[model samples]
Target: MIPYVRDIKFEYGAVDQVSPLIRRVVANNPGPFTYVGTGTYIIGRGEVAVIDPGPDIEEHLEAILKAVEGERVTHIMITHHHIDHSPLAAPLKARTGATIYGCAVTKVVEDDGGVKTEAGYDMGFKPDVSLCDGGEVSGPGWTLESIPTPGHTSNHICFALKEENALFTGDHIMGWSTTVITPPDGDMSDYMDSLDRIRVREFDTLWPTHGPPVREVTPFIDAYIAHRREREAQIEQALAAGPSRIRDMVPVLYAAVDPRLHPAAARSVLGHMIDLVRRGRVLADGAPGPDSEYRLAG
Candidate 1:
């Protein structure tokens, strides 16, 4: 089981210095997915870099501006183009005169078998500086190396803080819950590969955009990998019984989970099915998708 951290004591819009060189300001857009809203991170001191500017809320934008009152925001970095992660980047850049950096804009997955437009994605996010894997960006006292972790989204990038030996994991890895991997753009095969890549890295901590920091690095990542493998095993077991669709398997797979999140769960199952079909472990009628029926291969 993943050691989940659900509770965090933080006031919305207040910039709290979580580390020697890292400060966080939580946006007040709380929901099922965004636990206590988005945690916008401020890296370095006088000349700083902001990661994940978060949603386009006026109050949150005002708070960010206030937090960096006399400082120079050299870079506005984003992890992905999720609605809650990058909407405020343009406005923040306009105010601070900072160049936006992070994932390049890609084709939006209109119908990935489960969700459609307005599916919590930011379609208008276009970064001024698109960073690929191993890309580095620096400011006055800090340096960040980008690690492309394309799972939660095809363009997801995790920034590593060299000074702190920490990784800003975005939604690739979260302390609060398992990431939702929808099909098409969200690939389970890529997600698993990214997890393996992160496991071999030497990082002391992981700071997720939604929840509290993950301090026990190795065990946490190991648990995450194990949890995903268990989910895959469950999928295999479900397929062994007979041919099944993602919508039919979700209730049995996530019986303990809240009913409201079942839709998202089904999408994640579709990601797994796609991976299974590619590996020849499962056979789909056509292209693996949310509605496609699948069964164990011979």
Candidate 2:
């Protein structure tokens, strides 16, 4: 199991202090992918840094503005350019004059397979300061180190709060569920490498944008990695029978999952197939994709 944390106590639009140096204001956007909604985090006091300002709903914008009413928002940090995560940054920046930092927008736009309607990428998002892996940004009392973990999206980056030893994992390692790796931009090879990268880091806690905090950090990450490996194993087993399309394998691979989510599951399976093809473990008819047929390498 992934040691999922589902229950979070918070009223929408109200700022709740989650830790000594961190406070969260939940946006009123909830769904299958968003869970309760986007938990926009405020780091440090007085001169603070806001992480994932969330969607562009007027209420959400007002909530964030109210939360930082008397404080100076020195920095606006984005994890990725997803519509839910980065759309509010522009308006927030206009209001606060804060420098936007984090990953740049992905240039390539592939068929997201209906996943875009739920949580699409915000192509207009461009950071004033692009922080690569090991980059650092600071405020009055908090310093966040950028840990680029680009499996969820090519530009997805996690911010680590040095003072609290807490990592703000965007969609890379959500506590509520496994991340959806939609390809072309979302790669399984890169995602697995990113997982291993975070696994070695001794972080005290993980705060995902969409859900509550993850306290048992190491075990949670271990289980996440194991789950992916298990899925890969299942794919391998399925391939032993014959060449198969991602859509064909999704039903058997994700039988327990909601049928509504099978499309997303197929995209994840496509991610695995891309990785398998790269590693020479599986052979694809053409470029590995959602519609491509695959078989175990001879």
The regions of model 2 sitting more than 4 angstroms off are 110-118
For model 2, name the residue pairs that clash: none
Model 2 compared with the native: what TM-score?
0.96
Q: Which digits, one per residue and each the tens of the lDDT, describe model 1 over residues 129-236?
A: 889555898988899999999888999999999999999999999999888887667889999999988989969999999999999999999999999899999999
Evaluate residue 161 in candidate 2 and report its C-alpha lDDT on the 0 to 100 scale.
Answer: 98
Each candidate: how many clashes?
Answer: 0, 0
Question: lDDT of each prediction vs. the true structure?
Answer: 0.89, 0.89
Which candidate achieves the best TM-score against the true structure? Answer: 2
lDDT of 2 by residue, 96-117 (tens): 8999998786656865346652
Which residue pairs in candidate 1 have backbone atoms (N, alpha carbon, C) closer than 3 angstroms, thus clashing?
A: none
- Regions of model 1 farther than 4 Å from truth: 111-119
